[model samples]
Target: MSAIMKKAWGYRYWVLVILWLVYIINYFDRMAVLTFLPFIQKDLHLTPVEVGQLASVFFFAYAAAQISAGFLADKIGSKRVMYIAITVFTFVTALTGVVKNFGQFIALRIGLGLGEGHHFAPAIRAINNWFPFKERGRAVSFFATSWAVAPAIVPVIVTSISVSFFGGAWRPVFYVLAIPGAIGIFLLWRFISDSPKEMIAKGKLSKDQDIEEENVAPKKLSKEEKRKAYGVFLKDANFYVFTLCLFCQLAVYWGTSTWLTSFLVTQHGLNIKEMGFFASAPYIVAFFAMMLGGWLMDNVVHRMKPVALIGYIGSIPVLWMLGSVEKGNTGLLLTLLLLVGFFVNLNFGSIYAYLPKRYPKEIVGSATGLANGIGQLGSFISPLIAGYLVTVGANGSQDFSRVFIFFAIVSAVAALCAVILKEKKVTKVPANTIGSEKSVS
Candidate 1:
């Protein structure tokens, strides 16, 4: 098994593949609602505010679950936490097909958020566990592409499925989407371990590198241990700034993603089918944006702030210009969407690359969880505020100008936060250096 595994692909690459696929499933299920927002809104007689509530509520639940989930990942093992997450979220997704009212939809959306929120920090923990310093940047960056990929293709795939197979019903699309998630569960069990030491001890892999891993078993933590873990990151002043920056970035991200489809349809006057392809245009550029951001962080900048700052600053003008676009100008609209996609997405790889370098790997899950969890507050409010700003006229048209302005404001905030961040320097150790700090910058 080991020889065949090594011959086909290294175990680390296999882990990346499995995690990436699972993340794609995670996002596909999450994005299905947004892709068909107009249908869901129409069917439920939902107002603009309520349409925004569905998206914001999910982030609220997702954010609320993150800290506990991060702590759980540190305690129980990333793989175990992931197993629970995949099962719960997938089940919740299937149940979404049958909701009959706003209350039921909110209940199930909360379920989906709680289930999926646990997966991310654990996945970050796993990447740090498996990859060495130099290569970790590229590894995490590639894994992050699942975000762009799932949303990029989901609009086309889900839209086509709804229009063709289910006769344009949104609910059935959720049911079809749920089936593929089980594959992620099975893959995680077959191929993943919590750490390299565990993999080596189990005879699934050989000790191929100079990594000296701690043989920490997943077990119940003492109250003091938990406190110390939480306290360590809590005391770090930089963590607050980092979290704030993440907050702004996610605010822009979720706000744009959650509302972009509706904006294209209602304001720009595109049919749903045309909206799907146009909706996907920005994210296609985003896939390359993340890749290039990762490459630049690893090879060129060697610092995360510059990359993040550039992304935030570069996106501001693009976002502001989106308000100037007139309906039926698909050419200019596509150009602006593509630009906004590139700029907002460019910093994720750089931000992700910064985490393992900034904190001890032992506490990375907690650090990441808290930061991202707080960041989700931004995620929650952006959509809700956008929904509030979305003025629906008596004639059934939407004015989305304020939403674009809001995104630009947040992008500016993120750039300012990036400017205040201090660069970190990792001490280079010999290949045999183990159990201390890993390379980040």
Candidate 2:
């Protein structure tokens, strides 16, 4: 094996493993609320619209916080920012149990969003620092697997916890979940260093140490110049197009996943437990699809380019078919939903892999944060909109048919936008250009 490959399979592999676990917890905490939504709704005596709004408040804060977090991650180091963010998130997640009213609930959800929002931009930056460009797709995808794993495992855990410890009460479920996060914070403090300089100096040096230090050493940029550069990134056509693509994708995926369990229970007449099992089926399929997709994107396709478009366009018809399925067709519904999960998550690693390839390292976190912030707004809005549609249906009916059709249309639009995404061959970072930490500046 090559030297890098040999190293990758050793201690560096452990680094990747740790990063993935951190992300798993990150996603677990973020999504644990969703799995418990039904219980929360019932306990609070909330209507469908209120439930949706509560769910959305987290995303609203998450989306807004990502922008500033991106900039802050660069100003400080990703490691420190992540350490603080994770601790804050864990505490807030635990505190969610204590909420007595809608206002308190809303405040806690917003805090959850803001705390969790910092994880992605910084995590991606750390991945770029740890792995070389050639291996990034697979490396990053390995981390991105948290999305699939979260839905697959977290719901099951939350269900068990609710049944066993919380006596089916959603409030104490949050408290129990927060205990491990305390340990997670300590591990982050002990192991994760911002860059290789810290890594090597801390006696953890390995190969490529020089390259990592070169990447992290501070540079200087004037305030006015930083503003001009941020302006350039914001005004770029390709950036906006990519943002819209993610927006559509998140809208469709979140809309479907957020409501899938409820849909199965209400429309198909399945019990809550059955709905949980059905909801988990897609994430199971997604796990294999993501692993295989990452391998294919890296080992075979190697274009590292437009393969994301294929994943997007291919999902349109699948989602359409999923929407068109009749309520009684359990076999067909499960099959198609599985495929939807696979294809939707298939492109996830590819989309994130595109950012570090296209942007200069200096601004990659900001650019990623910008894209994620814009895309995550869809996460904020999709649930709210879907709930409104269902609530406003004839005679308080919760028919998700129209919502499904809208999601299908959005998927197609995303495919069209993905087709227009520019693929730059190289990133040009001018030598000796010093600027402020551009986390948000």
Candidate 3:
């Protein structure tokens, strides 16, 4: 390869590209279960409540593991942590096909969650390490789009496999989707470097070039320093507010995404194919909104603490309308879902930008893990609640109306919380390890 091309695909860009691809596979494997849920429900003779419990298995494991994963990422290298995580989940997800009963199915899903739990906590840490302060928002926002895109494409792909290639066997769909994930493991193993120091050494690049390449100052922390870093973050009220806001956001976000497909089929008379297309539309809107939100949030950070509060508050009406719209008016329902998905996702970018902007780099990963971990609990609860509501109202009546209202109220509360978050100036960034370079008053 020419030097120009080699420089273009240098270690920095290569790491980012491969990690992004890994994230895409991460989301695809995790969300494959949702699209397959209706079939799983029928085949397993499970009730709606039982299905909700099964789905909750993923979140239970995910939420429970975040802190430990964050701690591990801080101790071990994030790349090694991620590699182990991806391998664990990929194997378990493939094995999900072989389960013969609900008990075994739930067990496998829980294991899937445990394996996948290590991803966002450490991946966010990796991004925070690699990207500069100004560019981190866009970097995080772009990766966050995996949540949007995987659901959009994976459903169609998995549905096709489930229907035709597998002779309508959901088990075969699980097995097939696991193939690409295994390939991702090999890619990560070959290309992923743990830190900029390692990347520079392995690639035979100058230390100065590596620092300039990633726009990061080389900072190494000891165990005590890492502990104190997290300690500082834990004592900050701003972190608490961000965590609470994220928790509420998760409730509404997952509540809608998890159930929207089934809602279309049961209440709006959408067939499986139609439901797949429509379900993907909102996340498509969300993809653009997240990108836009990240850009706008950074531009206006000094002036507006609640940069995406409008989007969050605005979603209440949109979500309420989503569940209240007429069954025959698919256009109107689609509009509501699309807007809700857009604004709800916009909050994701805004919150990520907001947090790191206000906090120092030393504890960015730990704070983010705590917030995102707490948020995962909301993810755990929302779908299970929706499932119970649907099960009890299963006499063909749309009971999800009240559920939608609940999320609207929860989102409104999130907006209010967003307003109260005090944005502090991140005064100093230490060069190597954590110490009192400059003090914050």
Candidates' lDDT values, in order? Answer: 0.81, 0.74, 0.74
RMSD of candidates 1 onward, in order: 3.8, 4.4, 3.2
Q: Estimate each model's TM-score.
A: 0.90, 0.89, 0.90
Find the candidate with the highest lDDT and give its number. 1
lDDT score at residue 74, model 3, on the 0-100 scale: 65
Candidate 2: tens digits of C-alpha lDDT, residues 283-321: 888777777666777778764335666677778778767
Q: Between candidates 1 and 2, which one is better according to lDDT?
A: 1
Question: Where is model 1 more than 4 Å wrong at Cα?
Answer: 1-4, 7-9, 45-47, 210-226, 391-397, 425-441
The lDDT of model 1 is 0.81
For model 2, the superposed segments whose C-alpha errors exceed 4 Å read 1-9, 207-232, 391-397, 431-441
Candidate 2's TM-score: 0.89
**Candidate 3 local distance difference test against the native:** 0.74
Candidate 1 residues 1-441, lDDT tens each? 656454212667788888999999999888887777778888889986677678778999999888878878887889999999999999999998888889998999999999999899899888877776566667788888899999888777888898899888888898898778888888898889997677778877776545544323333446665565455568766679889999999999888987887799889989967987888888898889988888887788777888898899999999988966999888999999999989999988778767776665657788888888998899998887877788889998898988899899999999998999875633322233322334334
The order by descending lDDT is: 1, 2, 3
Error of 2 at 81 (Å): 1.0
